[model samples]
Target: MPNIKSAIKRVKVNAKANVANSQAKSAMRTTVKKAENAIAANAENVQELVQSAHKALDKAASKGLIHKNAAARKKSRLAKKA
Candidate 1:
């Protein structure tokens, strides 16, 4: 609970941003899981899955939702699996 009005507003803004960030992170994770599942299933759509995963990771990194190195690491691992 923020005592100051400005602090209360800031908290509200932060809560909104937190929800948005969480959604983005969840999307990234879902995309990565899809890619990994495709790889594991030996699906013909592995390429598409990999591409989607890469794009999602890049977007997350660009948005500052994830670290650049972390994104690169995820891309590298996915590429290797693909």
Candidate 2:
């Protein structure tokens, strides 16, 4: 829909970034959910799950897929649950 060349390029770039960000965010959320579920179930592997979740959150935050403080908050909550 963008007629201008730069505008068209921008649109494409944005679309690509959006897809990548969405995937990263979804993965991060899934990891967090796993950690939470482990906690809820009193699973012995909660620490391992939390660690992986924190790593995923940090990776997402570093890539600008999620806010740094939001990631930190989530990590803190996950840690607290363990």
Candidate 3:
């Protein structure tokens, strides 16, 4: 509902960014959950799951989707579990 041209463009761009960020965050959370489940179940692919989770966390942090410290903390916790 932005009347100004620049404002309308900004709104559109923000909407696109929001969708992309949401997807990235969702994927990251799913990866972390998978790693946690694998660890708890004593699964054979626990290492791979953990590694993917770490990668997802790093990607999210680097993209500003999550705080760097937050990502580090999650990574540490995942490591501990593994």
Which prediction has the highest lDDT against the true structure? Answer: 3
> Model-by-model lDDT, in order?
0.97, 0.92, 0.98
Candidate 2's displacement at residue 75, Å, is 0.8
**Candidate 3: stretches off by over 4 Å:** none
Error of 3 at 51 (Å): 0.4
Per-prediction TM-score, please? Answer: 0.96, 0.94, 0.98
- Tell me model 2's lDDT, rounded to 2 decimals: 0.92
* Residue 29's lDDT in candidate 2: 93
**Collision pairs in model 2:** none
Which 10-residue span in candidate 2 carries the lowest summed lDDT? 73-82
- Native-referenced Cα lDDT, model 3: 0.98
Off by over 4 Å in 1: none
Per-residue CA lDDT of candidate 3, range 1-82, in tens?
9899999999999999999999999999999999999999999999999999999999999999999999999999899989
State the lDDT at 59 in candidate 1.
99
**Worst-scoring 10-residue span by lDDT in model 1:** 73-82
